[model samples]
Target chain A: MPGLEDLYREIILDHYRNPRNRGELESPPALRAEGFNPLCGDEVVIYLAMGGDVITDLKIAGQGCSISQSSASMMSAAVKGKTLAQARSTIRAFRAMMSLHGQALDGHGDGASGGGGTGAVGPEEDERTGAEVAAAEGVSLGDLEALQGVVKFPVRIKCATLSWHTLAQALDEAEKGAGPD
Target chain B: MALNDFGPPLDVARIKKDFPILDRVVHGKRLVYLDSASSAQKPLPVLDAMQRYYETTHANVHRGVYQIAQEATELYEGARAKVAAFIGAAAPAEVVFTKNATEAVNLVAYTWGRANLGTTDAMVTSEIEHHANFVPWLQLHQEKGTELRFLPLGEDGTLDLDQLDQLLDGAKLLAVTAASNVLGTLPPVRLLADAAHAAGALVLVDGAQYVPHLPTDVREMGADFVAFTGHKMLGPTGIGALWGRRELLESMPPFLTGGEMIRDVRLDGFTTNDVPWKFEAGTPPIAEAVGLGAAVDYLNGLGMSAVRAHEQALTAYAMRALKERYGDDISIHGPPPGSERAGIVSFAYKDVHAHDLSQVLDQAGVCVRAGHHCAKPLMRRLGVTATARASFSVYNDEADVDVLVDAIGQADALFG
Candidate 1:
């Protein structure tokens, strides 16, 4: 009986209606990356100004459904001032939380700690990998934790993660010392 | 009953029962299928016919003097006759069986276009055509150096006939769809046919979306060629037909010149068979054609006029219900109320990606199509990446529409 109303929370709706930091940053020292969801036509362009290990500035410009755009808005805010290591750690944690494998991050002695009561696991096992990736990386991602609900809707998972994937792409480009764009 | 009312009133519930695949659960709920635009569900009669053909008449047609070969040839030609009658063609010889509508369009482009079109020749189509209709013509343009033109659509999703006059000038062929698979807009086919004829252009109607819901008569439409698929019309996959005027078929070169399509073959040259056989090369989809024939008989028994009426009523009800429930939060594409249109309704819910909407609907066991519907140019015209579409058929009713409306309302409440 869980409905779409449960998926689109008021905060998500607000971000979609009144999108924050919704513009492209000019090219310079920033690494920019673009991600596209072919199924939904959701696209994201992430700009990251990395000052050594720390991300000094981050912004996103994209057009997509509420889930994708709001997820991007939330993503830009979360990674703005984090160090490169911290950003990767936070992304791992966030991905883990969304994949409902946060128990792996909880470290309850058992190496195979499953995130119980998360209701994140679905019939599709591929989703569990997202959680496994997050568990592998060490960070604590909260609030964005709400996106775990996306696992129940497989198609929406792409929308919720388009921005994150773009951010990951940006970081990859930064590591390579190449412009993300 | 009169000859006009040759068919019986469709027992929709019984027909629905015949489709065993329809009686299944998806996402832990009863499946409510609404994606008939992509492909239609098979009925028991069509399925049984195909099974019977494979069981009894399983042989390569037109070669062996064996009993099975004769039976197979008879059944295959009979299927061709049924297809010809289904579309109101004068004879079975005018119907050429192809793999599907895409291949049918390709056949025209490769054979007809290559033989007739020159650098000075032109091909005209609309923006709303499915890629099957669009790409083949584009390939023809590339190969023959022919000019390719498109009839622009108005804001309301209808073709601008005023623009059509200009595009049709000096055009050799007008390849257009009878109904848009995405927008659900039924173009003015008779009008376009007349205009193309006046401009000295032969018309090829892509009836892939149209044939499934409405009754089609090639003579009445005055089209030179009409292409459609069996799968979309409650028939088996891998079978489709291209109905062309007898003269056109005779004049056009063979599409695939091999095997049954040939009369005599020498080391240096070969002679092709007559009319439909000349175009249908290799081993045709014999069993699939048999199923298609049964499908035609089934639809004829149900009466196409009634089917058309039923869908129109369902579409109107769906449109009214969607507007009432969601107001402007949902954007419905295609013709307005009372205009000639199909049961396909393509739209995007405010702030929700079509895939997201489809997921929400799938969870509710309400199936629909989410993507460009193979009309990328039409999607660009509509200024959206994709839209979720729910198309109706004879099997669909008010309850089906309610499922779609309720699902959309749920998506709106969840994502808005």
Candidate 2:
């Protein structure tokens, strides 16, 4: 049987026990967004400092189960100092990596600089594009990639995605130049 | 059955068989239903009674003069008698059927609040009331400018009645729950009633949670009005009763007027029907009432005292087993062991989201409720947005608790 050792990896547990970047930024240059999972009492507040097209800094603070808190910790570390375009691309790559059937990217391109991509593709084609994009971008998702195990436990998916959703909302707000309270 | 015979040490297996739905599967696993505080599964007798009523004596009650209508009316009124008797009301005429307990509480708020409460009048309630009980009074407060006071809950989830004397002063009404749906804390109803009465305030008991597991006598509790739903007590949905003192019901004006609730209607004005019917307007849940009567019979046959004892044992066992396994990691809400509490257990496991916990339990075929439980104020008071709750009934046993504990153990492994 799968155990906590498999899901709550040492790094994940460490983050939960002693989380980094776990407080609100004072008068943040970027927008702040809050996300809550009503069913589980999981809550997260994302703070982003944006400079033009780039995310200069990112921080997340909240209280929730280990999956949610650790996921937020990892997300804060991964998305900091990345551009808006780069952040969106990384989200797509991360989603693809978590796919149970090892499916490929659908609409997103294979780490190409510009937008124009193929209309439709098979599952294998999508996987190839996802892998090619990760390699080309040299995006080191690192321990953040361990969240692929979360898909197996469908319940924990919400926890893993809590920070990502908040971050997405915060980025959207930052793009609009409106602070999300 | 004798009262002594129906005391503690109930037969849980036989009780489990009485509920037909307990035998079914959900999500390809045997259903370990622990959401009875939300709504209970109906027994065969209640289902059959509803079916028989619809099949044999289906007609508009109290309006038609035909034989079937007379029979339907008899059964409907007979069900009122059963409800009145069930709650130890002084007379059957005091019981008014409503769609559900929410409607029952609203009826009292609209009727009694209009008559008794002025701008200066105040209503005292606890934070533990379900939204059904809380919202109507809140609306009353909004409309009439009545002051809404709340009794605080102690850390153990029981009401801190030490301040009841101070809180009850100048209050026009006190609406409280007999048993909290979330915490399962059985409040001091009789004492509260006495205190409220002494303070010249009426008392309304929300019996939605209590009537299922325990035997309630409204008169004995000294409550002026007691509201409960049939669905939570093994009956069909869309049926509940509000038992008020006869004089109080008679003094209060009609909440909803039209149809069978009237005596005479004219172009200029209309005269209302007598007592309970005046409160119950239009076509009521006649068949649902018959089903509730059958449920009462079913429970009476098993004996409510036995049912209460059965749930008490199950709750105690669950508390002990869960504490032994999880220790401080699992925080159990409500009264401590040996305290007077119902079967519901609201809890949170450290670092486990309630929804995730419920989903894990669901996968193991152990169903429980995971949310704020319509007690947002209580949830806020508890400092949690949501909690996973496992509520017991006559049908639940130690084995069911074992399943719940096992599921939680599995969840611990997943989130540790």
Candidate 3:
């Protein structure tokens, strides 16, 4: 019963119109990874400039739907200038929020619903807000919480997660190619 | 039905009553399905035929000496004959039933292609073919080391046949689509067939998109092999057919060798069955074949010429509507309104991504396909990552096009 208003929030639309860190970083200094959602032909390229366990800079390039582009923009803005551990935790928390893995993230057995979600949370629905999920993972979502509405539409979940997956790929590759520190 | 430039127009309102799914409501709006190119909605007769076959004559075909088994075999074989007649095949034995059109293309590639082609041989196809036709030949090139050549696409979304003679030269086989699934470009199959013939090569036409909307005659088109599927033509998903010349089919070895495909099993080897059954390996999609037979009957009743004409008129109306409403804001890819294109209308509205456009259209119960359409090569040729395609069928009319245009406008308003 979720409407388009819930999926395409003003914040998401604004982020899509003006993407953050929208360019390419030189490959010699920065690691690049690409992700593709073959279903919708959504491609996300993540460029990460790492300075010894800290992500000094991040840039995104590609084309896709509003959900994907906005998610990529929000992700770039959230993770930039953060430590490697902080970025990884943010990635995990954001994935958990988007996938509605509330039960696993919360760890507590009780079904206490988290507050702060602006949309209608029916009694039958999974009521854990993105903030609560992030809090459980010991990280905050900030503006990326706008993408939590994508959970209502399962198909767009891939679109939202595509950039994050590519970022993770960039991190993994960067670490692998790094020398003894 | 009255005569028009396209042909005798179809009675869409009357035909719409035949498909039960046409009455469905989505998002509190009446369903306006324009993804018929991806898969057409099944009519009542096709559904009834499938259910009736399962309820009354449920048995494995080409097996058992009992009366019911014989009846089952008759129905299954009868379905093959109907499919052959639908496409104007020379004989029923020339049509080999496979899982779907993809499987049919692979069968030809593995059997006829692998057997005849080699490292020196060159196989010519087009840039506009679906992955089903493209990948099989690519695989052939990879394994057999055969040279692969593509007929380039022109700027106007048609194949650049000016290079046809050069590409066809020294080629052993030419595999091409009868219609481009993404661009709605109807390639000149007869012309291509003749050119390939003069080049001393065989022709395989991917008729998956063509057969459903247009009147298909394998012989008239001069095709040695024509591949089409049931699902896209209002039949069930599991059944499809490849109609080849009987001599060509008989000459090729069995692609999948097992029980039904063999005449007799020996200790060392087995003799294969005759022509079509020689390629049909195991338990076939019997009920689906029966449904396909019923679909053929339904189309025949409506007439294929009428179906083609209906889609042509609808495509023309949709083109005019979109241009008139959007003007410089919308870009439609493919041949112009009258250039013998199929009913597929792939468009990019304003700056809206195809996925976003489709999502908004989904709210209004307008189902369209938004993606590379399994034609990434063609997408690249068209200089786009994806496009929102609205295809028409016998059941769709002008009202459907109107709804589609309005929904597209809604997308533009929201995105803008």
Candidate 4:
């Protein structure tokens, strides 16, 4: 079985201790979305400032476990200054990396990420997923890949992914030009 | 029939043996289960009784003509009597077995609330109640436009009942928890029940936390209805009891309609069965009921007072240990170590998130519940998103607390 070292890596703890881009943004320009892990009552709020389909600035505001807080911190650092499409691809790659274990070990994906494309079904599917992950390697998960260990502990996967879900929701709202309620 | 004094104090080592899960080694360390508030580890007797029921007396209850069927029906009804006697209900018929205490409260909200409440009617609950007691009333209010009010929590971690009379003034029901699951604050339930009665309002005590820890008497509690689950009390899951006043249950309609909970039926409309049975529709959790009966027997053998005493002492030790070790760094969110609370000790250690604390503690084979504890409104009242709660049961002792304390110290070293 995987140990605590696997779950709480040094970089994750560093990110948790000194979170990046931690605060709220003005709602008029910054799209905000709140995500909640109903299982544990962990809440994450994502605020996005878009400059013409590019994420000009991103700030995360909320409280949760080490996984969640560090993830939000890492996510802000990763997605900031990236184009919308780049950010989306990064989110997908990060999610895919996090869910890689759930697919291989648990034969299921975390419900937040629909489980089909990257799931290794047979030899051919495994090769395709390998290629897909290699392509996502170009997207560069960077420090976000530190959360890949969260999958060993399935319950904490939601914790690590909560900020991502909120970020996705914020992007969705940005696309819709919807005001933060 | 009474909360009889079985004998001496619970021999911790002996008691630990009864719960086989205690023998488990998690992460190469001895299991130290402190999450009994979430669900207690079932004793061998409870497990064995369930298995024995399925092995020998597995048949449809109350519909048996054959010998095995009759035995099954007897066992099922006998379990009801055991639960009734355990809680000091007037009769077995007063105990309505449900899927869990949540369903029991829902049964009351659907049946009694539907029959008695209307738009103008108001129901008073407390901030510390589990969502089981709180949500059903809220649902009643939402569906029927009934007004819902809350008894606020005081600074001392207990309900501020100074405004109890005013809150229950025109209320039809006072739905509250006998104890706060998260804070472990044992509200003055008897006093609240009496006040509700004086105000001409029925009281529904959520005993999911209370019943497992204390010697309960529905008559003495003066509650119209008391809902408690089995899983938290060393019994199996999927079986809980709602002890209601017989007359009130008789007056209300059936909550769930189906096979077993009927005396007569027509194509147009069907007549519901007796008080408890009327609420318990379809095939009940027969084996689970048997397991609960065995659990009641186990607790009775341990003696509820003894069980309470053991938990009280252990909680005191845990509180003292935590405070002594962590000083101002640890904040235990409950009544200051005493009988005023159950064994639940919800705490936040030096800004460590509950999940993080629990995960670290898990490495030391210490299991604890880390969340809102299903009391979100209370979490908001406490001004925290979640807390790491370590609750004690009959089996838990000083050693378990020491293990918990040591593991928490490890967490402090790691996260400090």
Question: Would candidate 1 be rated incorrect, acceptable, medium or high by CAPRI criteria?
Answer: acceptable
Candidate 3 stretches with Cα past 4 Å from truth are A100-130, B1-8
* Stretches of model 4 off by over 4 angstroms after superposition: A100-138, A178-181, B1-7
Q: Give per-model TM-scores.
A: 0.82, 0.80, 0.94, 0.94
- After TM-score superposition, what is the CA distance of residue A13 in candidate 4 from its true location, in Å? 0.9
Could you give candidate 2's per-residue lDDT for residues A1-181 as a string of tens digits? 2333456676886777777777777655658888776445567888788787788777777767767888788877777888877787666566555441222222132211112221123355445333455666667676677676676666566667667667766766776774343
Better of 1 and 4 by lDDT: 4
The TM-score of predicted model 2 comes to: 0.80
On residues A9-92, what C-alpha lDDT tens digit does candidate 4 reach at each position? 889999999999999899977888887877788888888999888899898998899999999999899889987777777765
* Candidate 4 per-residue lDDT over residues B189-220, each given as its tens digit: 88998899899999999999999999999999
**lDDT per residue (tens digit) for residues B102-203 in model 2:** 999999999988888879988899999999999999998899899999999987779988789889999989999999999999999999999999999999
Task: Determine which window of 10 residues in candidate 1 chain B has minimal summed lDDT.
Answer: B1-10
The parts of candidate 2 lying over 4 Å away from their true place are A1-22, A27-44, A48-58, A63-181, B1-9, B26-29
Candidate 2 CAPRI-style tier: acceptable
Q: Report lDDT per candidate.
A: 0.80, 0.81, 0.87, 0.86
Clashing pairs in 2: A104-A126, A104-A127, A105-A126
Better model by DockQ, 2 or 3? 3
Residue B357 displacement in candidate 3 (angstroms) = 0.5
| Candidate 3 CAPRI category | acceptable
Query: How would you encode candidate 3's per-residue C-alpha lDDT over B110-129 as one tens digit per residue?
Result: 99998999988998999999
For model 4, the TM-score of its B chain against the native B chain is 0.98
